[model samples]
Target: MLTSKQKKYLKSEAHSLKPIFQIGKDGVSHKQAMTILDALEKKELIKVKLLDTCPLTVQQAALEISMQTKAEVVHIIGHTIILYKESEKEIYKLP
Candidate 1:
């Protein structure tokens, strides 16, 4: 779990990042989740974008992806979601 300050810091750090993945009409799938897990292992923080054709809402997609990847949903704005998981590399030093 992340504290408010940590989430804030992560949000700022992710601001300039492009979405590494996208949830489209097919919605979230096991394969997609697993792929996201792999990405999370490499990058502690990542952005996921939801397209207009997606079946799930932003909150639902965030919940499902976070649950599957065991990553925290740091922030959701517009159609983008910022997720964070502490990786082995300890890439970002959160305050």
Candidate 2:
């Protein structure tokens, strides 16, 4: 779990980041989840975009990604969602 302060800091860090993944009409898929897991492994913190066409809520998407990757939802603003999982190569500490 992330502390409020940590989450706040992560939100700020994520502000300028562009979404690396896009959730389109097809929505989240098992294959996408696998790809996202790979990305999460490579980048401890990253952003994802949820398209308006998707029926699922951003929260739902975030929940699905977190549950799938065993990561944390750092923040969700507008159509972008931030996710974090400590890098296995090194302990990527949160602020």
Candidate 3:
């Protein structure tokens, strides 16, 4: 679990990042979740965008992806979600 402070820091860090992945009409899938896991390992923090065509709500998609990837949902705003997982590289020093 991320403290509010850590989440705040991550949100700021992710502010300028483009979404690394998008969840569309098909919704979250196993393959996509696995790919996101790989990405989180590499980047520590990432943004995922939900398209208008997506059926799942932002909260639902965030939960599914978080469960599948074992990454924390740092923040959700509009249709974008920020996720964070500590990596071996220790990419972002969290507060």
Each model's TM-score, in the order given? 0.98, 0.89, 0.98
Candidate 2 vs candidate 3, lDDT winner: 3
Estimate, for each residue in 1-95, the C-alpha lDDT of model 3 and write its tens digit.
Answer: 99999988999999899998999999999999999999999999999999999999999999999999999999999999999999999999988
Each prediction's Cα lDDT score? 0.96, 0.86, 0.96
Q: How many residue pairs clash per model?
A: 0, 0, 0
- Is 2 or 3 the stronger prediction by TM-score? 3
Off-target runs (Cα >4 Å) in candidate 3 are none
True-vs-predicted CA distance for residue 18, candidate 2, Å: 1.0
Cα error, candidate 2, residue 70 (Å): 1.0
Tens digits of per-residue lDDT, candidate 2, 1-95, equal 99998888777777777789999898889899889989888877889999999888999999998998888999888888899887777435666
- Of 1 and 2, the candidate ahead on lDDT is 1
Cα lDDT tens digits, model 1, 18-66, are 9999999999999999999999999989999999999999999999999
Residue 27's lDDT within candidate 2 is 81
lDDT of 1 at 15: 88
Write down the TM-score for model 3: 0.98
Question: What TM-score quantifies how close candidate 1 is to the native fold?
Answer: 0.98
